[model samples]
Target: MSGGDEQDGPKHEEEGKREQVTVVVLGDLGHSPRMNYHALSLSREGYEVNLVGYTGSKPQIEVLNDEHITLRYMRPPPNLSSLPRLIAFFVKVLWQAFFLFFTLLTGPCNKALLLQNPPGVPAMPVCWLYCFLTRTRFLVDWHNYGYSILALSLRKSHPLVYIYRMIERTFGRLAHGGLCVTKAMKIDLQQNWGITKVTVLYDRPAERFHPLTLEEKHNFLLKLSSQYPCFSSDSPDKTAFTERYADGRLALCEDRPALLVSSTSWTEDEDFSILFHALQDYENVRHQFPDHYPPLIVVVTGKGPLKVHYTSLVADRQWSHVVLLTPWMTAEDYPKLLASADLGVCLHFSSSGLDLPMKVVDMFGSGLPVAAIYYPALPELVKHNENGLIFKTKEELANLLQDWFRGFPQETEIKETYYDFYKNIDEFRKLQWHSCWTCNALPLFSYGKQKHAKE
Candidate 1:
């Protein structure tokens, strides 16, 4: 839990009168998109949600203001290097655990502690202890098993890996229930760890990601250019950049350009090199097909360790149509950018091979067709050639892209395909939400309340 200015104080009398109250714990607020979604969802359900997380560069406290919610910010840990850094990390974890213990201890009664994993080694043990001491319900929301992710960097048989796995399994069984992002994860937990009280809560896009009219898209591009000067086509250095629309056969018309958008964090698990190689292949083969126009490939990404290296790689390649933009867009602009795209390419391969990417959800919500790099759990969301296409290798992805460009080039066909895909996506979204909230979340919280009542 992160420390910050406390908002509304706990209502001792009123809280006791109510069935139950939840204190949602998150470790990495800077990048925990799923935690943010859970906070918002819990708040919307009229539950008193106490969000405890780090409030680093992007302060989320202001946006989360509600009568039923309270925000608590934690100080970000120091980014020191080597042995001293490792020591500092452990010390910070202990310090955070100390503060979080009291926060949960002194808060409202009939309590349920909802915690996100990954930082699980430190947080889960503390939360489990707190729940045990206070007779409170403990639930772990599994985005990816922390130990599996750590195994990506360290040896699977390493002592630390074994320790993390021990912590996960030990405290995980103590949890009343758990929520996972994918069904595969849920099955794994039950089969391997005997943690059967878990539910699959698939990620969903925010309401902002939806279809936009042609005029709306044009205005959005204008606004986007204004907000990020680098994106402006009128800039002298950006003269080669052109805005064109598709004529219906995947060919660019006189004033039309096929927009391809991909958002990434540029991390190791993503394998962006695959996308780059596929793009290279597309560029090499594009000219052979005279009827189609080259797509203006837009890559929207956040700054990361590999960003500079990848940017250099892209620049050295000198692909004529590729544009790499790193400007962080406002919440309002991100969906608009997705909506304006003719297609979306997702490169996220789960570090743990269990976690699913939320980027695809956003793309599907925007009614955009997707060409997602395939992983084990990805097939659960992306149906090959149904809602979207999935590819296993660079060559396969390039071939898929070429096929898409060759197959759909007319406006009427594009509209029909777009709507057909959108309808399927719309239905899937509805079903997912219903299952996540009504089937998964409601029961978990209700179980806590029911247990509290019995006690």
Candidate 2:
């Protein structure tokens, strides 16, 4: 049966057939949508899942216990600054690794999935050592092109890049299987690092992201528009809703075009500046084609010290075009909010390699057209001029927006292609996407062996 129907069957029989396996999830569970989905999916399958993550407003036990899984949260250190935070992260990882060692020694763990974080490579050698000694299979969840991410983000090359590459190589060599999020990453592992056991597991739309009812979609858009400053609120007497900026800089309006919105966590390495700069160049799209220009709003969502600083950049540029939703948002509300958007944007600088970003899947689930940088993995999803537009430079954006402003003369055809792509996703090659945890990593039950079963 297809994955579309995969979740329906074997629900009642799942508990009876549940496997006794312990999976220690090590990462920022609060921020990790993929981790949450995988853990929840495993629990639904009645697996004995255990998670080790950070303490946050979101209850650790709340999410897992709801799914009949056990959870343990590591208390964060006192320091809140970046440097202190890094040090704290290292300490926490070490503590978790040691805890995992004990857990493996005392209890039973079938697999250990390590969601890697930068600067935590040092602990990997030790983790691998434990995995080797204990006979517990290890899965290194490779999120991106490590060398490329390092090359783009770090100010100085130093030995850190080489060190990271070395650790990754070692981990790739030692790992029972390397869980990559995209085909490009799998290829990178095999060709660059010479590791064979690589699997492509991408961010598939969770059950939560299924198509919403028309009323639900409409209601969600209502709330989003009402709360947003750009959308009108004070004048309830107004006959029709109008879109205008607070500065009155944006007066031109057209058919309430499908909204293009995006939200993401701010990482020091991510080049959102490139996106913001491109938006500035695309201003003419909003001016000339008031009918087709999306909300001309870019929403920055997620918590970070740089939020205020980044918003200031938007405000300083008089980019009334952007909004900052930096505070916490409910998971239930996230998909609806995203779905309300007409388009989605995921752009990174040239230094960023071809690893699939989580936002791409989020946008796909939202069913919005995408506009992104011409990176490797994204092109797999975004067939230029078909589902989305890829800009090599800000100048290219101006040209694209100009065409878009012309009522997206090709909007209907383009949107249909995008819809078909998302609907018939499985028909495509399985090169870019991987099967969550089970497919990529070899189970601890089968060490020193290799086999495959149809999913």
The model with the greatest lDDT is 1
Which stretches of model 1 miss by more than 4 angstroms? Answer: 1-20, 57-63, 82-89, 227-254, 407-420, 432-435, 448-455
Which 10 consecutive positions of candidate 2 have the poorest summed lDDT? Answer: 425-434
Question: How do all models score by TM-score?
Answer: 0.85, 0.75
lDDT of 2 by residue, 8-86 (tens): 3434355465444444444456666665655665555445556556556453233544544556664443443556744
Model 2 stretches with alpha carbons more than 4 Å out: 1-18, 57-66, 77-123, 145-156, 233-254, 284-295, 317-328, 349-352, 408-455
Among these predictions, the greatest TM-score belongs to 1
C-alpha lDDT of all candidate models, in order = 0.70, 0.56
Q: Which stretch of 10 consecutive residues in model 1 shows the poorest summed lDDT?
A: 247-256
What lDDT tens digits, residue by residue, belong to model 1 across residues 1-455?
Answer: 23322333333334553334554554656466666666655554445676777765442442355545566665555554545745765777777777777666666664577888876867898889888888888999888888877877777998878988999999999899889999899988999998999988888776677878765675676676666543466533221233434432221234344567888877787778887787777777665664564454564656567777877887888876455566676666778888877788998888767878888988888888799988899988898867988899988988877776653345325655556666787776664443366567767877745678899
